[model samples]
Target: MTDPAAAQAPTTVLGASTPRTPPARLGVAVVHDLVEAIVTGEVQPGAVLPPEGVLSQTFGVSRTVIRESVKRVEEKGLLTVAQGRGTSVNEASAWNVLDPVVLSALVEHDDSLGILDELAVVRGVLEGSMANAAAGRRTAERTAALQHALDHMHETIDDFDAYSQADVDFHFTVMEQSGTRLAPTITRILFDRARESSRFVGAPAAEALRLTLEEHQAVLDAIEAGDAAGAQRAMEHHIAEAWARRRLPTARD
Candidate 1:
């Protein structure tokens, strides 16, 4: 990873002695543009990048900036640099898809490059299990907290941003109520990412919002009844339905 301190330092051109104050976020800007281009297929894998001199000219930055930016991409598993062959973009399969940078770049792309489908799988497995575990730990206080979030959802149905925050808090609260250490932390990151992209998989339509409430209510019901298997199944169904809704060209998409 490029150190923030180093990124802030004045960058010297390949042959120059004077330290030049780099443009604001020069390295990060270069990395983001190149990542979007690659992930969105404007630049394909196996294609060789132009030489650093050309990249510097193209981005209108110093040679040092180009190098640092390229280094950032390479570190993220998007590019490979060779002494004699220059830099080559790697296939998406080879990239570190789980890295927050890579995931955020994909999310920020026009359509997430279809990575949301993959996220659905991860959520289905992890959250379903979390829900199952939560059943054993469910208490009146925990149930009330979840119902409070759900109530917020109902009241803010006309406000998507508010509803989205409530939705995030609802699921993250579920994980916490599960009495697990890692699940909440892992889910917190993914939930925030999905929320940012409007990919939290809910909407304000009467049907959509009602369905969300019903689905969450089902999970809460199962937990309140102390049915681990039912809670797991309910959560799994909710996740699958959410994924299906997003796959369509509907508002949730």
Candidate 2:
């Protein structure tokens, strides 16, 4: 049984502001708060949520809004709603990490940077496979386009923003040449999400840009030579090493 006192959610925990969430977006606000609370461990796994009446009062929304919001959180694998026992947060392992809201919350709260580390590993594997496929499927035109992207990166090496974009262009060119739909889509989503995290965008030293240029050149050479195995290795090495160079050390490290 849940301790009665534990069920009383702090009003601030629900993100109740002085003005309160407008009725039009009460459900969304409630859901966002609940997810963040669960993800950040403000609400621990197996802790019962407050009763519907308490929640409605705390959030200043109707009981109906509370029910709907809780249901949405349950659907995201963050909550287990027992019929009579009340809703409880699930373990982090149960979360839908790919869900945009869940992913955003995880990234925002990732103080140790473990999530970004895992993100890099996943990107390296997926991008390596794509590079391999691109090598096999490369036509003269596709190879030329990739070379052009590499050239742009070289030209813009002094301009961080331009070089960063060109780097993305180089990767996109390879993914496009692979002609695989699902993998590219998933990779793009993960890549975009990681890029949004400041922890994943640590300051790059001038030497870092030079090293990146060298890495890109290696990948390009392997792909242009149609060395599928070599391309896969080059792409994987670049992603993993690039992330290592940028990853900020935490106390946990």
Candidate 3:
């Protein structure tokens, strides 16, 4: 028994609100719109999408473009196309959250900040393990490089942009020192995506830079001393606390 009011609720049409997407980028635009629609729950799980013809008219694209774009979205694990039935959205558990397009949409449209909070938890676990590994495998050269990165952060502490990059460099150094390829690669993807979202990089506390610097120092000291447990705890705490400081409050009713 679907509510009549809910059934009549307006669906968000990206093309209606935004400037026209360029002809050359129609496919990409369509895919982005579809992804955004699903991620924001404009189209809920199990809801069959409108026919290709309808979507074509809605997006001002040819039926072929709409078909292709739907396929692209399907490839990202957001849709299921079946014979004798229209294309339907899959559940969130079925989504390929690592896909850049999917991930970006998830972060950008996360009104409740739940996605970012989950991101922080996953990052804390992964980076904590990496930091533990780094402590066990630290070399003099690697330690020196990490020290230099921290020094650069100190030098650029007053410059937010520069300090941010230096902060990335320091983390990169630690990940590289850990000598595990896959974890670093995946962590980088997650970190990069989160950093790119303004919501995830929300207003920071006044002592943000100083506190961040101190946290980095603690991580470095633990790693340099080969204190694996200490390094792991320090790195986990830093990520968890950093996200807490920057996480924005969602608008309430």
Candidate 4:
């Protein structure tokens, strides 16, 4: 016969620990899939989700799973649930685009050009500020990292995908050197938009690559020389050139 008191003793001895078991939350994964579908416009705003019973049956899970998934989507501002009414998709503005799920949605939506342009504008502002700050605050190590990225860009000059990735890295490095949270966050968001655009992966114009490399060099030189004004101007020029290269049709033109 086992002693009830001995059996009741804590399994974890003072500091000795039991193996940690990972959480078993599949709700987040389900929520992400649904949210992604909505953001990509596969399920437009105001579109109702399948009934909870249907979702549970389809996913081979319980109503608790469905409810948890819906709750997660609601927290991301992608879903709306009511007592009598069903769950429906929310507007694009309701989403937190900086959230990775939202970013993926923006990329998946083929017609997200408008949002991409808006993102570019925001990026210009953020990167410009970061360049200026880096000019003033950059250490030797950060400057060296920028130079290395530039070298990588040159080496991959013939590879559009590689070159574009290096370009993103160079800008991100500058923002990191600025030692500020906001700039890095905004730069990341901008790069996410760029990746979604998918315009830089194919055969890019040689002229475009040359111009971009030169622009990056200019920004690097300005940052290295500690020329804040020059850095800001160079960054703005680089971004403007990229915008123009995208050949995005304006409302008037």
Query: With candidate 4 superimposed using the best TM-score fit, by how many Å does residue 160's alpha carbon deviate from the native?
Result: 3.4
RMSD of 4: 14.3
Q: What TM-score does structure 2 among the candidates reach?
A: 0.88
Backbone clashes in model 4, listed as residue pairs: none
For each candidate, what is the lDDT?
A: 0.77, 0.88, 0.88, 0.76
The CA lDDT at 6 in model 2 is 55
Against the true structure, what is every candidate's RMSD? 9.0, 4.6, 4.3, 14.3
- lDDT by residue for model 4 over 205-236, one digit each (tens)? 89989988999999999999999989988998
Which candidate ranks first by TM-score, i.e. highest?
3
- Give per-model TM-scores: 0.78, 0.88, 0.90, 0.74
lDDT of 1 at 84: 98
1-253 in candidate 3: lDDT tens per residue?
Answer: 9899977766476424333443578999899989998998888999999888778778888889889999999999999999889899999999999999999999888778888999999988988999999999988887899899999999998778888899899998888999899989888988898888888876665498789999999999999999999999999999999998887667741
Please provide, for model 1 over 1-253, each residue's C-alpha lDDT reduced to its tens digit, 9 standing for 90 to 100.
Answer: 9899866765323223343344588887778777877887777899898888767776778899889988988998999999999899898888976667777778777363366676777888889899999999988998898889888888887887787677677787788888888877676666567656765454546676668778888998998888999999999899888667655463444
By summed lDDT, which 10 consecutive residues of candidate 3 come out lowest?
A: 14-23
Rank order (by TM-score, best first): 3, 2, 1, 4
**lDDT by residue for model 2 (121-140), tens:** 99899899999999999889
Question: Candidates ranked by lDDT, best first?
Answer: 2, 3, 1, 4
Worst 10 residues of 1 by lDDT: 11-20
Ranking 1 against 3 by TM-score, winner: 3
Judging by TM-score, tell me the better candidate of 2 and 3.
3
How many residue pairs collide in each prediction? 0, 0, 0, 0
